[model samples]
Target chain A: MAHEVTVLTAGELRGLVQLDLAAVDVVERAFAALASGTVVMPPILSMAIPEANGEVDVKTAYIPGFDGFAIKVSPGFFDNPKLGLPSLNGLMILFSARTGLVEALLLDNGYLTDVRTAAAGAVAARHLAPAKVETATVIGTGIQARLQIEAAHLVRPFSRVLVWGRDMAKAEACAADIAERLKITAEAVADPARAVAQSQLVVTTTPAEHPVFKAEWLHPGLHITAMGSDQAGKNEIEPAALVAADLYVCDRVSQCEALGELRSAIAAGLWQGGTPPELGEIVTGRHPGRCSDDEITICDLTGTGAQDTAIATSTIAAARKAGAGSTILT
Target chain B: MAHEVTVLTAGELRGLVQLDLAAVDVVERAFAALASGTVVMPPILSMAIPEANGEVDVKTAYIPGFDGFAIKVSPGFFDNPKLGLPSLNGLMILFSARTGLVEALLLDNGYLTDVRTAAAGAVAARHLAPAKVETATVIGTGIQARLQIEAAHLVRPFSRVLVWGRDMAKAEACAADIAERLKITAEAVADPARAVAQSQLVVTTTPAEHPVFKAEWLHPGLHITAMGSDQAGKNEIEPAALVAADLYVCDRVSQCEALGELRSAIAAGLWQGGTPPELGEIVTGRHPGRCSDDEITICDLTGTGAQDTAIATSTIAAARKAGAGSTILT
Candidate 1:
């Protein structure tokens, strides 16, 4: 008989200690294992569902290298407001590889994904961003913007955080929350251009189809982590941004080409050279990272199966140690 | 705040009272959606990981029609002792196409998978098998064989069940268990040929490297559901059986080519004039099913993603209704 399964509710996940800085370490470790080919990573399979005058996208990726699957089910409704709920509600499954057991149940709907994605930002910063970066500018003041602020602080202690959302009040609230929680000075900027210009380390977390950040806003030695633009036809950075960068890195080269900032750059014939080094290759020391202090670097993270597996596995272990789950045998 | 998540353990799944044949209904619906081009089902992706001295295989499939993934993570350890554990262990994820929300988590490990596979058998029988079929024979006496029996009972009332295994005692014990639980008279047959020759409906559920049942054993007006031969070099029915059958159906053409008994038949040039209809195609009415009672139809159920999605969704819903999980807020 198997032990009782532990259920981690959305409320429970929210109440659990924010896995901010520590989660970065966990993601990094998982990537390192992935680079060494120690992790079991599965491919991403996606389907497009055409319903009555509408379509929904469903994608599933196996991260055996991490031992879990990150399934993204997104429904596009032109009338989401009429439904009184957000258009997107996603869930992830983290199953154990050892015994083929589902050790932990994560029911954040989408909160866990947002938080873990922010945690990835922190992980990328520790490895790619410059040390002791003082300022962080985040585009988009949605739920992810707040998380990016908290997660960015885990790697670099920012004295000021500038945010730019579609709405001024929303951005202001995001900055205010970060300021109150982390004791960092937070300011809402009127324009994305100004926000990116103000900070040496900029994070783009918007769902804008148009280019929100331009090359003119980027400076030498600045490290930009493009957090949004995860799907096709969604781009947050200008094409010039790719041409201006001295170094470019991506989570997965194939995926980034189809669904990240690379999509726009490639479409504009700006991505002339070979594919950027995989984050794993950089972590494994196969490719040099940040060759010069003055060279501008950009890390494109569209998210991958490896990250989902890592976070899910780590959370299960933590939940078990904390006596957080019940065991029931089958 | 999100609702408290319910955690359903394997024990809870085992203790489930209403297994809700609704999953069977869901699969049936999904198949109909499939043939009409209303459903999009992609081919499965498989990755082989070579260990220090052994190798492990990871198989993944996306069923757009069902909005779910059926992932199988099984050990390649063909050398391990059977210590009452099946070699396959993994959980299926069911994502709601309506909201892209994961509606349920079914942690049957492999038990749910076994039942679902059997349910597929039931699904196949509803469409392909002869109506009011009386005699049935099961090739192997493993746990999968038990499921096949139970699932078959759902479709046709078999007053007599013939069982055969490598070991005579195990086969007799299986017959005893079936007789006690299903209240049907199950008789153990000493030889595989006897079991196959006697029944109008036959299901082979063994992990044999070579064929166990010969073409000579099969009679006219028979329906053979080849449940085994899911992997390369694992076959239960002879290639001659393919030549003898008047109509043939498979789960997925690409998958069957690599792992099912279809591999051998295809290799031997036995798949001559007609292309075998997919089980989904038959379910969706794209292809004719069982035209005549004596048509000698055969449904090769290698299993597919639709089955997995249906079961996972149904299991999770059942778990939730029973209050089978605890709440953990993160």
Candidate 2:
């Protein structure tokens, strides 16, 4: 039987979907599905090409009740920047959950991943951040830095934004981009500790090998979403920071233990608390997320296949509604 | 940077590549690369959708010298036949190993997979089968059953073939097809034990939950390639069969332990040998294969990501040479 596969380019996807409340809601629903205990998400299939300084990760999940599931291939070549190319780019293929047939090919070039990842930050902040936030800070000066602030602003309505990175120029550029795009007060802070001290919500988006945010900087009424540590050896928050937080939550405990900030804490013997509650549990009201306004909470975002499936499904639906993308019969 | 992705439909792919000597050589090179100890092939990422009685597996590998690698998504919906659809259908994505950019999309609907799997059987037969074989038997009436006979014929030049399956009618049909295609005498045998006893080479290609071939059927100078046990709980050969064989090899030992006939042997405590030599080792001359024509041999093939990568890379090259795909810029 011939099957029609809709092929959407990055430009088409960007025009169809954005890091908005709807996207955040889609990701939040995915978290709820994860909490429902029926989603089948396998461990990531990762391959490292050291010669090219590149790594590719394949992630997929089957979410019940969804019409389709997505298999996302994300490739990151750190040395690509030297060749005047972006460090990250990849695609997603959505297949029919009922028939296991290819339904669409999304050549988002990492745009959907960026949106879903930032939306996850938004979900974490929506449940854990202070009720009212005046300032927000994002560590790292990548595309995620700008998107993270925009996503957090959707829920927190922060008036000011601070961007911190090792490269001051890149940080300034990221802050400028966020300020112009969101029409909010944004500045690049020289010291990460100072940025964390002044903000009610902090989102770390770096792929740093060492902690970029310190535990001594932890303050009351602060909510931190550490999303940089998706791979082992990539740490953005100090191990002690998780211990100092009033409550530590993660997208998935098992994933976080191996690939997130939890990995660092466990290796340092600082995480005596057994298996912290997942972000999904808090989203489902199974666990109270933030007890009081003074509570300092941290949510580790190692990323999940559920989010990829969710965003891909939502994007395909939106594209169908918009009559976007070219269809090829195979 | 803009990139062009070549998309090849199943018909296009079939036109460009075939299960010939070149294809077998490509797979053989992949096995040799596997033995080189430099290939990076991660564990398969599999998800089961029980509601649809379906499962999807994602596999990939990075061979150092290959210009590109493949990430294959294979979906098997067992109930699809009831819906007038094939049980297996999926695609492969070839990406540039250097820059991490997608180069081609192969919508072969599992044709490439079938060819590679059958070619692996030929690889085993080439190194381990008796010096000359007049009769070969395939113990399942599926597509692989026919292809395995064709593949083994490339190595052993078998003049006669036997088809055995639980369903006599289907086995007769498979035998007729093989006879017409290979121009060899083919007959459907009702008894599997009798078929194995008469054949010099036997290939099991069924998704049976229990042993379909028994250890009691083992005979000197006979070689068996069991390719159906690629999933846990799926066994084609009995546990004692490995112990009865003078030499037992596998595509990959760790995979065989988890998802092949070796798993059953280890569970039954019938296999005392620790880590048998891989087929790749024999291909690379690292292990002596087939000490004598009278030595019974068994090769458990659970499949590997390296074969997928090798076939994808070769297919893309062939497609490019033939100019047989649609190129879309993204």
Candidate 3:
């Protein structure tokens, strides 16, 4: 029998999905599913074309009970920006779990990745950050910087957002976008340490080759979301900062050790704790998150297929509900 | 700038590709590229959905100078046959190596895989088998049994063909198809040894869990192409037969040892020859393929990603020339 595969575009997805707590809940559910012991997630398939300064990673997870699973193709070419194309772009192909037949192709051009990643950050912060976050700082001027801060506001309703970047012009532009979108006081901070010291929640979204924030800047009642460092050799926070944190949780502990900021901490011997519990453990109540307002907490997120599958699931459903995207028969 | 992605269907691809020496050369080129050591192929990403008895593997390779690379998704559902669906089906996604943008989506539904696999077999036989081949035998009665025979006839026009299968009825039907397609005298042989002794070149394409052919059946001046056992623990020839052969080669030594017929041969301790040279080495004259007509040579094939990329490259070009598929924008 022939099948019609639903195809949704990035614009259609953005128009259908609102950045809100509901998104946070969807990601949180994925975390719980990850902790449920029935998800079969293979190691990511990563191939690099160094001549082009590009790499593509394919990630997927098959949750036994779900009707669908997603395979995400994420391509990152550092030189793309010089050619006026975004540095990151790719799509997701979702298949039926029962028959291994493709159900839909989500050509969101990384929109779903951005959405799920932000929702994951917000969910992590909600469980680990202080009850009330008055200010949030994001240390990057990329699309992720603005999106992560906006996602943080969804969880805690932060009134102020501080942005920092190597390129001050991009930083100022990012801050302006945040202010206009959230109707909040958004400022471009020249000093990352100052932003870290003043804010209750800090989000690191840069593709930093070295530490972007210092250990001396961490405060007692602070929570940090390290959204960068999804690849090896990318770091955001000083190892000493991780050592100082009373609670250091990762979106997925194994991934953090292999591909996130926590890898550097472990290599530096600053994070000596025996396999820190995952963010999913806390979300599922398998472990307690933050003990007190004064306890420093850090969540190192390297992203996961579970989150991608969840967002793809919800995105396709919403697209169908709104009658969005084109349909092609196969 | 946005790009339009070409989409080709299985029927279109089947219509465009003719099994011949040109196809054989395409696969041979891929083998040469693999031997050249410039191909960047990551470990296959495989995820299993146990409840459904299904598994999906994604394979790709980036040849440094190619304009595009292919990511092939191959899905296998053991129970699909019972549901009136093929047990294996999937497609390949081709992307621009320079910009990391999708160049095309080959919805060939495993047609490209089938093509390249058969072509590889024929290529191996061309370089390894004796120049004069009058008769050939094929084990198994599925699509591959017919395709492999047709593909082999392109390289060496055999006047007679022998077909063998576990089911005699299917074997007779397969022989009938071969006779009609190749305009040759084809017979369904009941005895494996009789078939081996009657043919100059033999091809085995079964999915046997245990050895289906034995060493006692080996004939002097004959070459065998073991195309089964692409996955672990599947065997076609007796380990003793591999040991009896004077020359043994594989498409890839590492893959053959890990997942092909050689894996079992090594386990049974019937073959202890140190890592055999790959067929590409002989193709490039790095090693001589056959020393004499009576060498009793065997070629164990465990397919590679290079073949997938190469076939995908040509398939897309052919589809473009034929105007055989739809176009979608991303």
Candidate 4:
């Protein structure tokens, strides 16, 4: 019988060791596959579930490049502390369309979501930011903000890291945690502007409805990676910051127009012709990255299915090699 | 530190030892969840990849009820013989949207797909078909045909099964397999008309462009379940057969109108109703199933996200309790 199955549970998946570098590398290869036209990735379909307090957002995306989908299902700002968990929790699935087989299962518990987001930052830094970049500033102290810092460190080799959050204690704790875990010098900055001005590379990760980072503090040689503002109503950076950038890159044009930082930029009359190329175009070598060292660059990642596919594929392979799960036949 | 991920692979999932009955029970529970409105299901998106010979079809469904999406990515027919494997192979991912965590990874290759489909049939049979129905006539000798038989047997005590296919040997082989597997007496019939004429319940599972069974062969006290023809340019039962059906049900009106057997029926100016009630409505008692035992009943399954959500949730729970897979946090 051809009807055999393998089953993997969330608890089992959560028990394994983390492979950060491997995840990044897998994302890199996924981009390659995406550019090779082997993958078909569609933008995620998101719907809002209204509750008594706030609403939950459900989004699903399919990446043909890696033959799977990374579906994000999470509640947003329920405001009930007793829930005692992050609003987002879901898994990634790697399915082989060739045989109509699901190849892998990942119980990320939003961890891989952060990993993929971080990996995207790493990719952006690898292609768009200068090598051996020293100082970095991270705005926002949420999970994404933390991941962006780690991902930027992976690619740019930063010696010092600075974080700014609305809560001073949270920011201080975040900086301390990073310093202890990643072994990088990290400190909390009181002013978001000061954090922006202090570093050559700035990473913004927040859920602000308005632009938290202004344009005036941006430097000429700075490379800014915007990881927040994935939702339609959210944005982290001012439109003028993008206007000042020498080069701009977007994960998906349609998505960026609807949700990413590019939405505001376009709303402010940023012409399409003058806009930066898509990330896939850059990955495919159809365009160059960071034309000049002094040129300000911005890479807007609202996230894409290609990255999910890549990460899911890699995770499944690694998990399989480690002897995970059980098999049953129907 | 909290943002670590664990991964599970296909091989590891293969080590899972749960049987189909357990999966069936889980899927059944999911259906109840769906009927209760506790499940949220998203739309299905399909991308077609056309090659030199045939094309690959990728279908992605977001099951909110189960808090994850079950994605089916399978290749075109051309890849089957060349690869020495079935054209359909893929895994199901059960993600918990509550915490943004993937709860289970099911690698049934497409076995779970059939299980879910069959479970849906059982769900339909539970609500729609006559309770004491016995004999069932199954057209087409594919995986779904066997599943329909099994699912029908589970719901009702079907002592006799009539199998019909284009190839007599294949049909006979299917009968032998069903007899051995389900412990029900089955016979391969050469004439499609004879099979349908002799049974109280009928199911069609084929990739035929035109319907094979005729309207005159169908009896008054009968129930027909059409599982094939999920895309355009595909169908099985004749339009006349639908005209002869007293009560009609479908998974989704939009999907059935575009791709299922309803497409042809709609084209031929069949019933005046805009769309049939969803199977969930019937199961939930919002809509009536069969009015009378003598009334001809039809349930057209184009598939739905709720079913995916249900099956995925169950698969994860079983995998977890069985202690399946090794985890790698990335």
**Predicted structure with the largest DockQ when compared to the true one:** 2
Cα lDDT tens digits, model 3, A1-330, are: 456778776667778876688888989999999888788888888988899999999999987677889999999998998999987888898888888877788877788899899999999889998999999999999989999988988889989998999999999999999999999999998988888888999999988989998888989999999999988879998889888889888877778998998899988987778888888889999988898999999999999999888888887888888888887666
> Across residues A184-278, which tens digit of lDDT does each residue of candidate 4 receive?
89999898787777788988888888998898987867888888988888888898888777888887777788889988888878545465577
Pairs of colliding residues, candidate 3:
none
The structural similarity of chain B in model 2 to the true chain B, as TM-score, is 0.99
lDDT of each: 0.69, 0.93, 0.87, 0.69
Backbone clash total, candidate 1: 25
The residue ranges of model 1 lying beyond 4 angstroms of the native Cα positions read A45-94, A166-169, A208-211, A214-218, A238-244, A263-272, A325-330, B4-30, B40-104, B131-134, B179-191, B208-219, B229-244, B252-275, B280-286, B308-330
Total backbone collisions, model 2? 0
Q: Candidate 3: where are CA atoms >4 Å away? A: B269-271
Estimate the Cα RMSD of every predicted model relative to the unseen true structure: 4.7, 1.0, 2.0, 5.8
Q: Largest lDDT belongs to which candidate?
A: 2
B1-330: candidate 2 lDDT, tens digit per residue: 678999999888889889998999999999999999999988888889999999998888999999999999999999999999899999999999999998999998889999999999999999999999989999999999999999999989989999999999999999999999999899999898888889999999999999999999999999999999989889999988899898999898889999999999998888899889999999999999899989999999999999999999999988888878998888
Per-residue CA lDDT of candidate 3, range B1-330, in tens? Answer: 456888776777778887878899999998888878788988778888989999898988887667889988888888988988887778888888888888887776677888888998898888888777898999999988998898888888989999999999999999999999988999898987788888889999998989887888888888889998877859998999888988888888878988788999999987778888788887888888898887788999877888888988888888878778888776
| lDDT at residue B94 of model 4 (Cα atoms) | 46
Docking class for model 4 is incorrect
Misplaced by over 4 Å in model 2 are none
lDDT of 1 by residue, B1-330 (tens): 343333455567677623235546766664555455544555554433333112333333334544444333333333223445445655554545544444445566666667777877777878887787788989899887877887777777788899998899999999898888789899899876776666778888887889887878767768888988777777777887887878778877767788888888887777674667788888877888888887777777766665665556556666667767543333
Number of the top TM-score candidate = 2
TM-score for chain A as predicted in candidate 4: 0.90
